[model samples]
Structures are given as structure tokens and as C-alpha cells.
Target: MTALTLAAAQTIAIAGDVPANIQRHLAFMQAAAEHGVQLLVFPELSLTGYEPTLAAGLAIAPQDALLAPLRDRARELRLTAVVGMPIRVAPQTGVLIGALVLGADGSLAVYTKQHLHPGEDAAFIAGQGGAALEYGDNRIALAVCADFSHASHPRQAAEAGANVYAAGVLISEGGYATDSALLQGYAAEHRLLVLMANHGGPSGGWACAGRSAIWAADGGLLAAAPGIGDVLVIARHDGGQWAGHVVVL
Candidate 1:
């Protein structure tokens, strides 16, 4: 396909409800597939929601029972999906905040949040590797929540020859107003297309903003979801620019 169709869903999940979250994510993936979207992205910590209190108890190994269905869904839909979850690597080391990329063929790749906020430092470990995955003629670099706010994060992706950068985020109510502009700025400076998926409703006693958005390499906002219930935003890119309609699915 000359034009790449990308979609993101801003959905909510109660803290620690893995089954429901996976079901919701699968529903969105199915919708994206039906719409002929090549890739679908979900919010950060989407499987378990942004519940720091449950980090220790909820953390799961990368290859665990909880994620098997998601892998199957990706293969079944023949769609690339990015989902975030808290991962436990070792006992001494705390959990790591991670986003896993499931290729249409069932291949797996990952990107962890290298920078942890003050509140997350105690519960999550910072990731060191910077990686990018190629799919459907697009070099996609994946970033976790808060990673895109730093200049080095997007710069690393751009330097790695990534034309598109995607972030799975949990943007709290107050945090959205400040960080959204910064995300846009990063895209502009790096000359890369940026896509961010954020949680929609309340989770862990915190209200979240569901305004998932897509920005052109020039930093122009192509599509933005109003902060509300679950919503999907789609953006198409052609000739290194966003030149398509913003469809809500």
C-alpha cells in the first residue's frame, strides 16, 4: 500500500484487571483491522492500567500467560499492535515499564521507558536499550509514557533512521495540558511522524486524558481525540506528510 493507515484507541481499564483490559484491546484491534489499518496502538500500562500501588503484585514476566492471547490476536488479525504492561525481570530489580510490539506474523519486539518519573522510580526500573522496528514500509520507533517528553528520546529514534515514532502513554488530567505541546515539539524538531495513545477514564484514583493524537513530521496535529470515553483516531501518511482524513472508529 502506498499510503499507511494507522490507528490508536484511547481506552480505560480498572487497575489490575488484566482480562478485561486484554478484551478491550482486542476489540480495538479488531476494529482497526476491519478498517484496513496496518497498525494499532494502545495506551501505556494498558493491560494493568496506571496503578503504581499494584506494580509489585501485578508485574508479569515478558513471556507469561497474560500476553499469550494478545500475541494470538495480533497473528489472527494480521495487524501490528503495541500494548504496554509492567514487566518483572528479576527479584532484586524492580519492575520495568514496557511496550511490546506484536508483528502481524507473531514476532515480538519491545521498547522500555528509559526515563522514569519521580513517582515511578520506586516501582519501575529505567530501560537502557533504544530499538526500532520496521513494518509496512515504515520504520517505527516505540516509546513508553514520558519517554517522548525528553529531546534525546525522539532524537535517538530519528538518529536510528525511524520515520515514525509511537508512544503509549497514561496522561493524567493535569499532565496532558503541559506534555501534549512538548510531544508535538519533539516531532517537529526531529522531523518525524508522532503518534500517542493515552488512557481515557479514571484509573488508580487518577483521572486520565483520552486525547490520543497523531502529528505530522512537520509537527502539525493531524488528528486528536477529545478527552472523553473510549475513542479511536486514524491518520494516513503519504510523501512524508499527513494528507488524509481523521476517521473515528
Candidate 2:
């Protein structure tokens, strides 16, 4: 569990197609394993391409077979993968936009989105708060889009002694600059290494700004996707310093 390398993935996701997206995720995970990444993160609602209109019907149950391939791949590669999907909050009630953490030991953990965007609440239920996953000495906190924008979100992570803050967002071109600045602020103020995973193609009918990136605890950019396609921005930590590179698949 002594994780040294982490990656943020930017990839094309098929809207409303869980099986196809899972296939895409498997390919991405394969590429990440070849690059020696201990953990790989995908953008929000990656499995369903942020299509809120189809969320309720496409909500993945905890024991669904669609998740089996991902679980098996994570176990085989011995690398953790944080993937996005819509999860049922309650039976026949509604769903919560969620990030599912697949551990190398074949374990699954979920973190639901605590904050929703302007009109997302109509389809997705808001969660209570953010959640963190642990790997050896590293405690990585999970945050969806608006959750990272809130000041109290990082504070909560700081209170929990988290060393990494990971986010999955579908940022448009116009919003990238502002969101990146805010994320950098979180990295500097909280001393948490920040990482973001975003879509490489259209999702939810929005043209996504594909710039999956990572920032050092000191707020310096470590790595970022060049343009689009299937890309990975990876950061490796050594003796308190981080070195990074971008991998194209």
C-alpha cells in the first residue's frame, strides 16, 4: 500500500452506455498499469458520461456484474482505480452521483457527491459530505465538482489529515481557468497534493475541457494532458518531491 505514483485520466466516454464505458475504463486501466501507476482516477460520472437524464435508470447496484470486470482488472493489475457512476441512494427513491474506489485487494468503496450544480439536484440526490480513501501513509480525499469549490470541503479533508485531494469534474473550456485556480489554492492552503480527472470528449451534451492534471503540495503544476484523446497525467513522489509526465494511449 505504499503508493508512490498516481494518475488522472482523460478519456472518451459513451453517453448512457455502462458496458461500453467499462470497456474503455479497462483499456485505460491497462495503460495505467503499464506505466506503473498505483492509482488511477476517472472523471465524474465516467461510466455514464454525465447524462443525468439517464441516471435513475442507469444507476449501478453495488453487486452489479457491470462492475465485475473493473474489479477483476484492479485486482489483476494490483492498482486502485476510482471510477464514476450513478448509485441508488435508496430503493425506488433516487440516485447519487458517485465515485467508486476499486482497491487492488478486490474491495469496493463509494463516495457520493455532496454538492450538486445549478440544476443537477433534479436528477441526483446530494450526499452528506465528502469521503476519503487510505493507502499506506497516504489518505486521499474524494471531491466532486462543486464540493471542491466550497471552502469547507478542503477544511474537512485537512481535519482528517488527508495528504491528497482528488477531484472528478466535467469542466467546460471557459470554466477551466477559474477551477484550476481554485484547485491550486486548495493545494497550497491545505498542503494537499491535488489531482483532477476530466472528460476528453463530449458528455451530457457539453464540450468538455480535457485537462486532467496534477499539482504539487506547494501549488506548482506537475503534469497535464496536452489536448485530448486518451491521456494520463502522472505524478511520482520521492523524498518529498514530485516528478511527473504525461502518457498518451
Candidate 3:
């Protein structure tokens, strides 16, 4: 079987700065490519630093040409990257938290948050969610922040035949313990590998809890960032064995 390498990009965002954040993302992409990573996922609203008030003005259509640079880089490196941003399906539609899949083959896919935190509804609408990503023999299901809070979300992914459940979130330090435990529990109960990508610093005024992580299907800790900053929590599966490591960026 072909080896599969996945990484959670633990990055700090420049609040409401798309240009700067894009540059940072490119840097992470380069680092991940150097580590032979095939799939990389970033934190929620990474491009805009979880700033809800700015989402409407910052939101872009999924096909907007503004993402050309990121798309070009993904194709060049043959790396599939899932990046977070605010999106509007139509000019008249409300904004939604989006996780955009930039495929190595130059394909684009969209996954939006199906659930929202209490106050989030004031700024965004609940999405219908997106499709699974297929790579080699592995099938990946994508979740955004609050989407995983709903028990039915991951359960649906398992029923859909997804072996890997990846979530991009902006978790605050206070909520980290509870959230991480739930993610780990899902890994055990659903027998699905779980990967979490969290913000490395403050965003939307919340002190983010970095420590991005990956868990084995049985809920064993595979790899995790010690604290936070610019790092990559990576997991590799080859020859029927799983290995993990951390790369400081």
C-alpha cells in the first residue's frame, strides 16, 4: 500500500490580514512539503483570525481568483491543503465558516461549518457541510470548529466510511481539555483516526490553545505539538505501521 502522510499546521494568524496570512500559509506548505507531507490542515478562519465581525467583508466565493497563489503552490508541491476562510455561496447569502480543500491535482472542494457556537449565529449561518476527501486507500472527513461539537457530526462521517476525521478549530485554553478529550473519545468510539489543527496564538480576542494533535484509531496519542507557535504535528502510515513526529517551523 502507498504510504500516507498527514500534518496539522499549527500556525498563528495575523488578525484580518489575508495577504500576510497567505504568505504564512505558503511558508507552512513549503515546510510540510519538505517533510513529505501529502495532506495538511490548518486552524479555523485561519485567513482572518476567527474575527466574526469582519467575516462579511472578508468573505469570498469559493471560486474567487484571490486564492490563485495558494492554489498554484498546492499544485506545484503536489500537496493537498485544507485552509480555513469565511465564505458566501452567493452574493445574497450569509457568510459561513469554510474549510477549503486545495487538491494537489489543482482541484477545489468546499466544507462549511454545520454547527455554530452560541454567539456565532449572529454573524454566520449554519452550513450543510461538504463531501469527503479520497486519497489512495484512505477516506477523510472534514469538520470545522463547532461542527465536531455535535455528536452526530463525527458519527455521520464514520457511517459514511471515513477512516480519518480531521477538524480545524480555534480552541481557547479554557476549552482545550474538554474539546481534546471529546476528539480523542471519538477516535476510540468510532475507530477513526482523528487529527486536530488549532490556532497557535490569540485570535478573535481568545487566547488560543495551540498544541495541535493527532490520535490513532484506538485513541492512542500519535503526535502533538508541545506548546504552540509555528509547528507541524505529523503522522505517517506505511508498511502497516503508524509513526509520528513534530516539525518546528
Top candidate (lDDT) = 3
Q: lDDT of each prediction vs. the true structure?
A: 0.82, 0.88, 0.95
- Tell me the number of clashing residue pairs for each predicted model: 0, 0, 0
Looking at model 2, report the run of 10 residues with the lowest lDDT sum: 127-136
Q: Candidate 2 regions off by >4 Å?
A: 1-3
Q: Highest TM-score, which number?
A: 3
Q: Which stretches of candidate 1 lie over 4 Å from their true place?
A: 238-241, 244-249
lDDT by residue for model 3 over 1-249, one digit each (tens)?
358999999999998999999999999999999999999999999988999999999999999998889999999999999999999999999999999999999999999999999999999999989999998789899999898999999999999999999999999999999999999999999999999999999999999999999999999999999986988999999999778999988
* Model 3 alpha-carbon drift over 4 Å, by segment: none
Error of 1 at 118 (Å): 0.8
**How high is each candidate's TM-score?**
0.93, 0.96, 0.99
**lDDT score for candidate 3 against the true structure:** 0.95
Residue 143, model 2: Cα distance from true site in angstroms: 0.8
Report residue 148 deviation for candidate 3 (angstroms): 0.9
State the weakest 10-residue window (summed lDDT) of model 1: 240-249
Writing each residue's lDDT as its tens digit, candidate 2 over 37-128 gives 99899999998998999998899676577899999999999999999999875678678888989989998888888989989988998976
